[model samples]
Structures are given as C-alpha cells and as structure tokens.
Target: MAEAKAEFEVEFVGACPLWRGFEDQLAVALGAAAALEQKAGAVAVLLGDDERIAALNKSFRGKDGPTNVLSFPGPRVDPGFLGDIALAAETIAEEANSQGKSFEHHAAHLAVHGFLHLLGYDHDEPDKAEVMEARERAILASIGIADPYA
Candidate 1:
C-alpha cells in the first residue's frame, strides 16, 4: 500500500537560523502520525527566540519565562487549517545540551510533540501522557530518530 500524505509549512521569526530545512524535518516527524490518523493539513511553525516566546507565553499562557515549545491549535474539525506551533531557540539549545542530544534531534522531538498537541494529543494525565509519548516515539523512530523518552 502507498503511504498517506500530509502538508506542512514553516515560518521562522527571531534568531533561529537552525530552521533552514525544517519543513522536511517536520514532515518526517508528522508523517506516521498523520498517516495513522488519516488527517491531511498544514501547520505553521515559528522558530523564535527566548524573548519572543517568553512574551507569547506570558501573554497567551499567562506564564512567566520562556518555554521550549508551545502549540496553538486551530479548529479541531478543520484539518485543512491546523493552528500554529512555536519553539524557543535558546531554550531548545540549552535543553539539548543538557540532555546530551543534538539540536536536530531535540528539535525533531519538539516538532513531533507540538504537532501532536495540535492534533489534540495531551499529556495532562499519566495515561494520556503514555499514549502521547508512545506516538511521539513511534513517529520519531519512523523518521530515523530515537525514543526521546528513553
């Protein structure tokens, strides 16, 4: 059988130079999940800096400081217009260094994670977290990445 298809686009603002070819990377991360879910759509990813993400975090999430990744899901039923996902460059770099993973590896994990969130995947509880993480691991693995949780 032929593989399913999904569409995605990347939008970088701020100082995230590492997002040069991120569209393909994100497609890889989203591929298996999209195929399994049988959903076709486009996602807008913003690779921003700490300061920018922090402001968004504070304003939207009512939190202080920057976070690694944030997802603003669009109308769930409208797969054609999935919302946006944002990433913090500084936070991503720092976390990758601390976790002893490459920037690309960590970023792929984040992309999968945020994209999943846009697809209504959440980790607010143990069971849900397990399912989400498993999906993430599987998707990443399919794309030649390792299990991030392990």
Candidate 2:
C-alpha cells in the first residue's frame, strides 16, 4: 500500500519570528515526524505569545496559564485527518534560553512533541510516558535533536 501525505499549516499571532526560516523548519520537522510515525492528514500549528496560548489553554484544556505546547485531535480523524498543535513563542524562547539551546531547535522539538500527541501518543502515566518519550527520542534523533529527557 502507498503512504499517506501529511499536510500542515502555520498561523502566526501575538509575536513574530525570532528565528529565520522558522516556518519552513517546522514544516521539515513535521514532515519528518509524519513520515516516521506514518501519520496522514492535516495539522494546524499556531505560533503565538504567552497570552494567546494561555487563552487557548484556558478554553480547551481548562488551564490557567500558557504552556509550551498543546495538541488537539481533529474531530474528523480516522480515515484522514489527524489534528492540530499550538506553540507559545514566549515560553519556547524562555525554555530554549534556560536550557542553553537554540530557539529553532527547541521549537522544532516541541513541534515534534505536539505532532506526536496529535497522532494519539500520550504520557499520562509512567509506562505510557516512557514509551512516548522513547519514541520522541528516536524521532528527534532522526532529526539530529539531542534527547530532551537527557
């Protein structure tokens, strides 16, 4: 059987690019993740500040603050659609700076993380988290990203 293509879209709000080619880089990351996970469908990504993401976090997740990333499974999933992922620019930047990593690399890792969530991977429990993190490590390794947990 043939493989299914992964389609993605990027939307920017709140803040602008601190890293050049961020959107393109994200596409490459998502594309690679999609291929590795064998996911097929559209996923939307929003790059915004803490405020915008916080609002979304509140609305969808019932959280009170901004998070680094959030993933929502698309309703029409099954035969095609996967879901969407959102990232907070301010939080990502802060995390990258604090972690001594580049903004692009951190953001790319988050993008991969979110994409994996959209594909029905979760870490709600220890066993599940280990499996998910292992998959994450493998996927990120393929993209030359260091193990996030280590």
Could you estimate the TM-score for every candidate? 0.86, 0.85
Clashing pairs in 2: none
- Residue 14, model 1: lDDT of 49
- Which window of ten consecutive residues has the lowest lDDT sum in model 1? 4-13
Error of 1 at 83 (Å): 1.0
Q: Candidate 2 on 61-92: residue-level lDDT in tens?
A: 89999999999888853546577678888899
Assess candidate 1 and give its TM-score to the true structure: 0.86
User: Going through the candidates in order, what is the number of backbone clashes in each?
Assistant: 0, 0
Candidate 1 residue 26 Cα shift, in angstroms, is: 2.9
Error of 1 at 70 (Å): 0.4
Off by over 4 Å in 2: 1-15, 18-20
